[model samples]
Target: MGQAIVVTSGKGGVGKTTTSANLGTALALLGHKVCMVDTDIGLRNLDVVMGLENRIVYDLVDVIEGRCRLEQALIKDKRFESLYLLPAAQTKDKDDVKPEQVKEIIGRIKQLFDFAIIDCPAGIEQGFRNAISGADRAIVVTTPEKSAVRDADRVIGKLHSEQIEEPKLVVNRIRPNMLKTGDMLSIDDICSVLQIDVIGIIPDDDYVIKASNNGEPIVINPQSKAALAYRNIARRILGDPVPLMSLEEKPGFVERIKKFFKLG
Candidate 1:
């Protein structure tokens, strides 16, 4: 049986989608049968990130409603034989999905794949509930900013209430120099507050944006530090003991400003 993981963040713009895309790709690279599902409903972008948008004729809605079979909706990636994507319907709203429906879909997918990665929408609403409904575990992605961390804390609390055990953490968009200069939160700080094991720590690397714009996830590219972080994360998910990346000096104000607008 496969493990279903929901990658979520309480706040938007915290790299939940990017993490899902790269992690799914990374796991496939490691030889696992992985199917990533975009549960964002109306705001479907995981297909775009995975560069499989043009290939998506059917989506999760199509399978849930019996308009298409599960295999028909799955878009296989060329880079990895085991990698596949189940995109969300761009026309449907979050309310169009229910927790029970998500559970059923995940149950079916688990029968064939080794991992089911759910790209959860931001916030603690119905969409969030739908995303985590059938998840055997979860990875909460958050940035180093105060608001993002606060929202992550809220998410952790909600997960506890739902009885989801030991949800792992993925601290994304970290700027090491900013942490040294007291401009951003450190990994230790975020972990201390969240009180969970850190599964991954990805730096705020500019290469991620370039890779996204090219419609290629960084995990497939060997030159990206962020990609290396994600690769290590995939290994960790498979119970490998890999060393964590260290945060170092960050770029200056001009470079930092330039990095903010880059899409990743």
Candidate 2:
């Protein structure tokens, strides 16, 4: 059976859905059959981010409510043939589906895909519980800030209490220059507080905004720093020992030449 991993954050606006869309896309690029499930219900946006909004004839609610078959509800990606999206219902509330129902839906689809990535709703509520109910692993997305880290810690605690052990962390929207200038928390600082292994570190990049607005994931943009980071994260998920990208500003040609010549 495929792994069902939930991409979640305790607080909203921390790039949980973006991470889900990009990571699912990246994994598919690596030859894995991936499906991204949006469990945010009424506030769903994964379909839009994946550019499959208009193609969604049926959604998660439709599958659970028996209005459509499981295969009929899956919207295949236009770019990658292996990537699919199970969008949440925009017209329904979170209570439309219960946790057991979510688990049953995921269980049925897990056999057909290599990975099932659930884009969880923000906060600790019915939506959150339903999103994680069938997940085999959990990926907690957070920013390198006090509030985000604190909320992540709380979410991690709740995950463990619910028997979802050893949830990994992904720190998003990190500014290396801000960290150097003591204006933001470092990755080490956030990891120290959350006490979880860091699986990914996404840098703050304008390309992310442009790609999302254009209905494309940044992971497909080769020039984007955030894209590179996310691709590395995908490799890590598949047990590759890829080093974290150097977030510091790259050295100029002059500096590189000077270093090559052993001169200051």
Best by lDDT: 2
lDDT of 2 by residue, 112-216 (tens): 999999999999999999999999999999998899898899899989988999999999999988999989999988887889898999999999988998899
lDDT against the true structure, per candidate, is 0.91, 0.94
Q: Which residue ranges in model 2 land beyond 4 Å of their true spot?
A: 254-264
Instruction: Report the lDDT tens digits of candidate 1 across residue range 81-190.
Output: 99999999999888987899999999999998999999999989999999999999999999998899999999999988888889999999887778878878888888
- CA RMSD for every model? 6.8, 1.3
Model 1, residue 104: what's the lDDT? Answer: 96
Reference-based lDDT, residue 233, model 2:
93
- Best-performing candidate as measured by TM-score: 2
Error of 2 at 29 (Å): 0.3
Candidate 2 has its poorest 10 consecutive residues by lDDT at 255-264
